[model samples]
Target: MQHALTKVGPDYDVVVLGAGAGGMSAAIFAAMEGARVLLVERTEYLGGTTSYSAATTWIPLTRHAQAMGADDSRDKVSGFLDRAVGNHSSKSVRDAFVAAGTGVVDALEDKTDVKFRARPFHPDYLYELEGATSFGRALEPLPFDASALGKDLHLIRPPIPEFTILGGLMVDRDDIAHLMRIGKSAKSTAYSARLIGHYYLDKIRQGRGTRLVMGNALIGRMLLAARKLGVTILTETEALAFTTGPDGVTGVTLRQKDTERQIHVTGGLILASGGFARHPTMRADKLPQPLPEFSPSAPGHTGTLHDLAFTAGAYHGDTAAQPCFWAPVSHRKRADGSMAVFPHFVFDRSKPGIISVGRDGRRFVNESTSYHLFVSAMYAANKDGSHVPTYLIADAAALKKYGMGMIRPGGANIAPYLADGYLTEAATLDELAGKLGIDAAGLNDSVARMNAYARSGTDADFARGTTVYEKANGDPTHGPNPTLGPLETAPYYAVKLWPGDIGSAIGLVGDENAQLLRRDGSAIPGLYACGNDLQSIMGGVYPGPGITVGPAIVFGAIAARHAARRAVAARKGDAA
Candidate 1:
């Protein structure tokens, strides 16, 4: 098998910008296919949001699910995705993803040490949504010793408290429960303990814990594989813009802390620098309603490619789809009067919990909806001029059942929320409303209506008491229905939540072959884009788990292959 040849100079076969999951994967895959590659990134670390994300699941209908007896296929996956964006995803992009999906998976499994398995418990965001498949499509990385990465792990982002690296990969809530269950059985407990011990040893040796890499693991494994193949990663270097000659992209101008150098890399340029998640101007112009929320991504995601690509006469589209939908969060005014906030607590209201109101307090939508749906609703609700942030009202019983108060159950991140009255507490509803600046009358009315729903086991107003899964996931302490609880109990607590986004979606437009497009619907010669830097083929909504990572890996590899092919073809044509 011919791998990408690495010959460092002003020219090569490919120059992949950004060391994010997609960029890294694209660089490695392209190199593996015999293209000399240069992986450039802005941050000191390699994982963009991949290293520091709550990526707990992978999506798609995959071999794992089929082996596990899940009836999933490429056709179903394609149909499901088609329904997601109202079938607007270009046939070319969809076809390319489908055709390359298996190859990408097989390449990683056979060529790299990234171990993965088909997990049974993970589910689609909407299991009932049309064309949705249950399991097998999403393959999760078996937890591996981060220690293998040595000092490289230190530069990588830590796991978000929302997730845990139990063995060497990311694990979800169901996995945690299974671990506990196994611990209860004598035979299972002993076996499980050994596995756990191995994970602990890996972490101890490597200075990190074992984890399940839902999507993040996929990226992690790919990067490790790429690094093993000798992909040259230049960190802390920002690609300012494309260096264009009379022909096209000639090289890249990079900034290295008070020093500007124009490195003329001859290989095809792959702009995967990520979308403008941090660009104030783009956020203001594109997402007018939600206002750009705080992104955990690095500061370098300023859409350099967008500006440079436009200047180079590249075509970009789908800038209107809000990629990262912010979850509910709250901010606190520090001593300096400035505020620092985070994606606040989204108490799973599928169970009997209270959706707190504002000064005019009201229950807006079904709280059980995913963060994306909730944020979209918030944008729609407040678009008419309501900016008051809402609170998620939880009773002490409910809080205890789901560990709702902590920043990730046991994490210490939200102690400040409890300390500064940001998390309001009261023993009574009326008193709570008074404390939270809500009109007592409005509060009483909403609660009465909600309580009535609780009694009848039906949410007449907003259908809060809707899905069985929602009720099953609700607080068990709440009688009969889990989601229709009236927070009329003592020791009631309220956490303020504002809309927050995961990251900006919608980026560079590319053809099915992963070639970046020109404004006139032509390909940008040898350029490609993937991940958040490329317009999300998902059309704004996260169709399933790993929506970002799946395409990222699939197309990152495709971009590399196509670029190498382009190089090969160019060489052949020149000879001819």
Candidate 2:
């Protein structure tokens, strides 16, 4: 249902720039606080890169933890973060995030449509750390009925094409097993029928399915909630500059297509623009040498707002370990001429019968480790130029059962993949190594060593299946070890992998209240930042799943709630 735009004054009370998870949540919180807000996006779609993601948030000490009996605590999380992050980021902001996690989550659950469910066994990435829990810190969005948005459903960014299947069916990773068994069992067959029927019906009506899951569901809920509160939403709008006055950033100058307008604000100016991951200048200045050419993230975070933001005395946080978070990506051109940068995030590497090898055809890092760690290993291994573009080796059976990069499971067409040169196929190990231009003898030796390891049920080289997190991603039914298996299946397959920076780890430094700060540590009044615009709380260390989104939502709430309170206080003073 559409309502007339709510307004506290002539123009607006607050203006939220950027429509990612953080910015969207900020607008909703401001609106709930009785402030008329305008949510703006430079692109036509609202979800940003998050809609292309799994939409998990790593927030500790919530009721979800209690419900799952996760045995997690604030102190445990704090200790782990301290050990993992050290002084890479501001401790004050980190502590603030912990203190407000439960409150923000509870409020969203009780007062808004946004909802989350705990995964009982999704362990933190750094599971070896003392403060790490086996489960419950990570919360995922529940599936959403996108038809609730009616015609506005398209306003949300669609999922990445590579993440979907059968034209546009967005199936969960767990549900994929049931889909593969369509006719094998009665229950699976019925489930597959309903899912396929629902997708086709939705496609017939809206040109795309509306059963939103993962990050899209989360974005949809926020969009619907923002609309329910009469928040004005504008897409294809760009923020030019900030308008300042005695009350600080009083408003923003914006341009929509051909039109230009300056709207003064009575409340706050929130900057949640994704981040500088794609900015050429930032990439050169912040990232390491031999710069990456591909990113799996959405194209919105080009650091477009940073230059304008610097004019207001805001500067980048200087203490991060690296400028951006990482993942080893494999890219291929699609039939539509679009490039698909597939992130190898625990599908094939962690599974049995696959191993990542450098140019010398030797194992480099634990193939089953987290994506961030995998890329970091790539960077480390490439120092001597041996592994910049590593090759992931898997047998034909493994490729069919688990699927390589850019190829989904359920026996997808390997012929097309081979025809496109995205996947290299050969009948023998020596021939496979010859095609990849790697050492064939070394490849033979590596496979023989792997076969011995499989028989012994141990990864003597990198201990691939040692950790709980790695095992969680591995095949549980496999005998001996879940992640340890011989590459004995004939006809090997290979895909080239490159280091891909997924998102920026650095952003404008802010306080616990999510207010942007000057160099001297004083606050930039009425100027706030969240999402990637705000410096990550973990300080660039990949601690676990949902690290980016966890603090994003928490601080977005802090910024909006604080600004709303300030607006109310100012109104009271004027009345007095």
Q: Which number leads on lDDT?
A: 2
Worst 10 residues of 1 by lDDT: 1-10
What do the candidate models score in CA lDDT, each in turn? Answer: 0.66, 0.86
lDDT of 2 by residue, 1-576 (tens): 222223223367778889989999899899989987888888888898889899998889999999988787788988889988989998878989999999999989998899999987889888888988888899999999899899889988899888887888887766687888988989999988888899999999998999999889999998988998888888888888888766678788888777678887777888988998878788788887688988888888879888888988899998998778899999999888989899998888888888889999999899889999898888888888888899999987888788888876644667888898999999999999999999998888888888888889898889888888989878898858888778988899999999898788899999989999999998988889999999888888899999988888888889998887777777788799
Model 2 residue 437 distance off true place after TM-score fit, in angstroms? 1.5
**For this target, which candidate reaches the highest TM-score against the unseen true structure?**
2
Q: Assess the local accuracy of residue 550 in candidate 2 as a C-alpha lDDT between 0 and 100.
A: 83
Q: Once model 1 is optimally superposed onto the true structure by TM-score, how far is the C-alpha of residue 236 displaced, in angstroms?
A: 0.4
Model 2, C-alpha of 152: deviation from truth (Å): 1.0
TM-score of candidate 2 on Cα atoms, chains taken together: 0.97
Tell me the spans in candidate 1 whose CA falls farther than 4 Å from its real position.
1-8, 56-59, 161-216, 245-247, 258-261, 265-267, 319-323, 331-349, 356-358, 405-416, 465-488, 573-576
Look at candidate 2 and tell me the lDDT of residue 511. 96
Give me the runs in candidate 2 sitting further than 4 Å from their true place: 1-10, 410-412
| TM-scores, all models, native as reference | 0.85, 0.97
Alpha carbon deviation, residue 426, candidate 1 (Å): 0.6
